[model samples]
Target chain A: MESLVLKDISITLGQNLVFDKLSLEFNKKVNTSIIGPGGSGKTTICKILNGDLKYNGSILINGIEIGESNNYLLEKYVGVVLNNSYNKNSLVIDELFAGLDTCNLDYEEEEKRVKKVVKYFKLQDILEKRISSFTIQKKYYIKIIKELIRGCAYIVLDDIFINMDLKEVKRIISYCKQENITIINITSEMEYVLETDNLVVLYNKNVAMVGSTIECLKEEKLLRRLGFNLPFLVDLSIQLGYYGLINKVIIDDRKMIDAIWK
Target chain B: MEIILQDIVCNSTKADKCLNKVNYTFKENSINFCSGLSGRLLRDLLTLKKQRESGYIFVNPNGRLSDIGYVGNNPLKEFTCKTVAEQMLYFKDNYHLKYNNVQEKIKSALLMVGLDESYLSRVITSLSTSELKKVSLACVLFYNPQVLIVDYFEKGLNYKDIEYFKKLFKKLKIKYNRNIIICSDNISNYLDILDEYVIFNNGVLEVKGTNKELYNNVIYKYIEEPHIIKFINLVRKKKGVELDNYIDIKELIKAIYRDVENK
Candidate 1:
């Protein structure tokens, strides 16, 4: 699999070392979550990926150099979906569909594509509603649709799920999974990281742990020492594993429930 | 400080009345929350945007209007100063306090929000969203306000930042006897930290009780519960595995272990 890879990246922001020889890789199609506490350089990493911040290392997406790619073209493949404020004045549907080509397809074809993207996020019911009128929870979903329409494969969301509860975010996870979109959720919330395929934990400006979500969370004491608690399901699954009720730490609720049933 | 809103009738431009004969008495030195209400209604309560039809909001008798501090909902817009230290001094001036300890208070305020003295010199516009929020919180707490209102206070904050705020607010209530009232739709995030929840239904005071008291109430019916709570409820409903008194992840894990052990 072609992967988004960072090689020996280092960054210093105004005397603070944000990253020090930090290296990580993400497959192009798998969901990854980067989580850490405040001042842990989650946003800084996002800026570097989004080409807003300069760093002294190599960032390659499927072996294409990130620094050399044109801004407009670079964004299409490795775009970001920032947590746009709910009170933004621009109409969202118009904004999402603004930059596409108009050379060949007629209005109906474009509208059909828009409708498909809208249906992907289940926004068919409220596609015409004003962006300002949406509840705060739904606003992030709109950004996801916008990013998909903008053709961003490696989507970086730093704080989009800050206000979203776990249940709401899980639905978004399913959507991303079905679309095979590579999501890098950069935040301190364990909710997203627990649901994602890969987990990257940051602490003291370095990668503390990197593994599959279930495996990394199995470092329960280490995570707790870093001032974070595991997700309820992960913790429970670990405890059940200790009791020999389950053979391994399972991330799925249905699997764990069925295991317990057996 | 205590806030008593009695028989309050508030009308929206589109609707006849959003708040209908609502009544609530927010007590002193408590961590209070109001959920299931529009952010507009909650903002109006915290800000007093419009006049009530035939009711009154009674603040503590000796309370100066300046003592009531609001932290969010365009904190920068309400700010008059361009820098951090000056913001605290402005609050000092507005409160008509003696200027002798203004700098000291500014330092203490910044420290309260986990910012150091160096942050006082930084330009407000250069601060991050989390930093701005902490700065706003510091400015409000700098005045030693008896009653503090946090409107969607956890906005733009990470989980650890929220924990710091929870600890600080609890300290403020216990040590200084200050009232920390949060008006947020994200109730589950603050569920563990809140001492009491004041739920609103159709702008009326639907229920008011401690966290345990309000947990099983129908008010949580509308909004989603926190994941652990929902998980426990689901397990109980589906597998007949009833866990007892889960406040957080650790407790829930223990409860599950005990259940599985007994089996």
Candidate 2:
């Protein structure tokens, strides 16, 4: 199984010791939510994984020191797809696909991969249009497809769904699950946390709590202390769970109601 | 100002009509939500990357561009000042306000957005995403325009920030009688705050009504049903229980509790 490990990571930003001796491990094929308020080093962690930031201590994928490797070697070894928002004025669909396969020497293979992804996303109509001209939902779909073409088992989205419709967000989550992509959402949105496989709560530059979704959902006190805006459905479902209307905190509205009825 | 958009057709750069004769009246002092605006109309509403085509957009007391306060989805890019204090003074100076008592005005403006005086010295680049959003809103609110248009209103706000905004928007609506127009995809977050919703699907005006009226009217592309409404719907559909349309979870629980007791 694929796994990413951060051992004894420490980073200093100006006067703030943002991540001192921070350690964590993420196993493959399990989507995780890194939930935290602003200034909790969540984006910094994403930056470090994307080889954009220099930090002390070792970052390992399959037990290789990623921090010490050169960019050329790191490109082949690291496959974590970083969520980079498309430059609207500069990007069209074909250009975006070409940009994604930058490391490809085989043109035909890249073309095939692009075709497969385009078919999967049903991007026939607006493939030639400037991405900026498309709706916000279509833009999100394009970005996700571009990232998936990178052939990464590990996907990290750095708060990309802030402006997305909730239904589109759900579609992305379901798509990730179906494709067996180990997606990591680094966000401050509380509504997003309930849908993940695991929850990593970061507060004040440290791991406040890390557990399965069920285990973390019960940590309402910790969520409150971390100053997260708990989702309405999650709060209501938990309350109903206390009253025996639910056995687990079901994040899906229909499923939760079905559980209650059953 | 009461803004009227009649046959307001907006076109993308490629000359595709996105807003197909959208007609709506944004009444003064009302909190209106314009959801699912196409890229073209969305841009024209915020005066961004696109322009409007053959249409009539009439607004009284809005002769100058400064009369419409549009805080965009990502307003952080518009911040050119080094620090929050400078940013505040920059907006104040635009209104021809003197340097005297500028510090007091800046402080009060930051406070109105739930930002502390400490942020005055903080670098604009160093501010968090949420803080940047608030500062942008503060600068726009400082202008106190006749109509306030917040594009993607709840993009980066947490619950506490949203709660703070709810109170502030209420004050603006009730006391100052300022027309606040918010455009977002989801209405669930603004369940309690919004007065009415005007939906824009694809390029046309689909519906303009209250939350209750629009709940069952699911012809639009992006309309979020409140959790209570959805839950009550499930109970009614499955268990044959007739529950009145309750918007709050507490009220739904009370009705559910009564039903269980009677059973």
Candidate 3:
């Protein structure tokens, strides 16, 4: 069964229609990245999945309708990391762990799980620091992966990489893949989006394209018409292919080099 | 006036050390680029509050350096006002006294950032990521500081908005004689606008030079050159077309269109 499904979703904020007739399905074990320019409804889609925004369509979670009684049940399966500042009312990392302890999971087992994730993301030293003292980037770094570690089947991160370095982003990607957690990464950078299993392109308040990363890149002209740029590595690979140096267009440098040498 | 720094260092408990023995100088009325990771280090440097040694940080004769503007990495979290008008009023009330009209200042700054004036009255919480970035830039431009420092100026901006910022920065240099310093990880994005470029690597000042010198010597080989330039060179080998270097698609399109028209 699909983990999550949105049917003909439409959302309007004030007088501006942000999403119109947008439909998407998240498979059971696939990582998807939503790519678009700013104001292309990436965050709105995440909000809809998290039940933070109201939309005019049907949303299903594991073949169950998303209503008041089942919304709390849905919360247990989904984790979200918003782009805004986190709550900063003198909460420590231990307190956050304690709060999650009430979810009826094994305390010792969960502690081991949390420590593994913290070590993976290299957040051991700042684990006891106050939320107010942490920067915006660090706050999301702890919240996003920790939520995923606590048995959440799906994770939604909203441009959490804008302030991160390339190394940090790679760590997050590896963590998601290792945990076997379905992820929905929202980003404007084409390089980051092309690393995922599927790509959903949002443009002009509608679904412009949805397919594999290579398929989306193949429609570079159409994507640019919707106000998005092709990934730098992808474009370079294509140019090299034109020069008969490469046989395929991709974002991986090692793969491109191998193809060229072969 | 020129801003110079020698043996500067900054460190917080979260990380071991951010800036270490960094030395550089910003010439008078010049655009300087500081590229590094996004954190307190870059933010502190942009606002001219990072640790530094003896140096002359000067402002223009008629310019004032009192106002400090912060364009955060996530622009949505930068603003605290309820409405866009209130956001403009917050800056005007605290920083500037020359222009008391909040709407006019908001309109002008929005136009400078390539945003429509009709967005002035919208609620701050309702904006998208790109729109939020433009609004944050608008707030900074509204203050009209002599020394304008922007952090990660191209983080969420599209190509059109980037071009608009380049033109607006040039206009500010001409009209108000402002000295602008922008910090980012991607230095090539601002190569056209910056007069000088500096890279912060491993908590030290790695290199600093003019845009042309740095591009020709250090950056060109590291980064992939634009596709159209590569295409033009590949197609026309013997008699090549002399195309100007551009970091954007619009300029490349214009150059190609002109070449085709001449043919």
Cα displacement (Å) at residue A133, model 2: 1.5
Instruction: Candidate 3: give the clashing pairs.
Output: none
Residue pair clashes in candidate 1: none
Q: What overall lDDT goes with each candidate model?
A: 0.73, 0.71, 0.68
Provide the lowest-lDDT 10-residue window in model 1 chain B: B10-19
lDDT of 2 by residue, A10-113 (tens): 98865668888888888988778887766677778888887877788887777766745445444553344343445576455676566566566577777777
Clashing pairs in 2: none
Q: Number of clashes in model 1?
A: 0
Per residue, candidate 1 scores C-alpha lDDT tens digits across A1-262 of 7788888889987656878989889897778888776667777777787778888888877887666645454566776766435465556677456534522466786677677777665666665566666556666767666666555567788677766755657767766677677888876667567657899988887899998888888899888777776776677777777767777776666666667755
**Sorted on TM-score, highest at the top, how do the candidates line up?**
2, 1, 3
**A182 in model 3: Cα distance from truth in Å?**
1.1
Candidate 3 chain A has its poorest 10 consecutive residues by lDDT at: A253-262
Q: Which 10-residue window in model 2 chain B sums to the lowest lDDT?
A: B39-48
- Residue A203 accuracy (lDDT) in model 1: 85
Candidate 3 lDDT over B1-263, as tens digits, reads 35555566666533313656666676767788766533345435545667433333333343344444567656666677888778888877666556757667778888887788787789988988778888887888888766667776676666556766878888877777777777666664675778887766546665678866642434433333333444444434434656565555456446544664565
RMSD for each of the candidates: 3.5, 3.1, 5.9
Regarding TM-score, does 1 or 2 come out ahead?
2
Q: Kindly indicate the candidate among 2 and 3 with the higher lDDT.
A: 2
Candidates 1 and 3: which is better by lDDT? Answer: 1
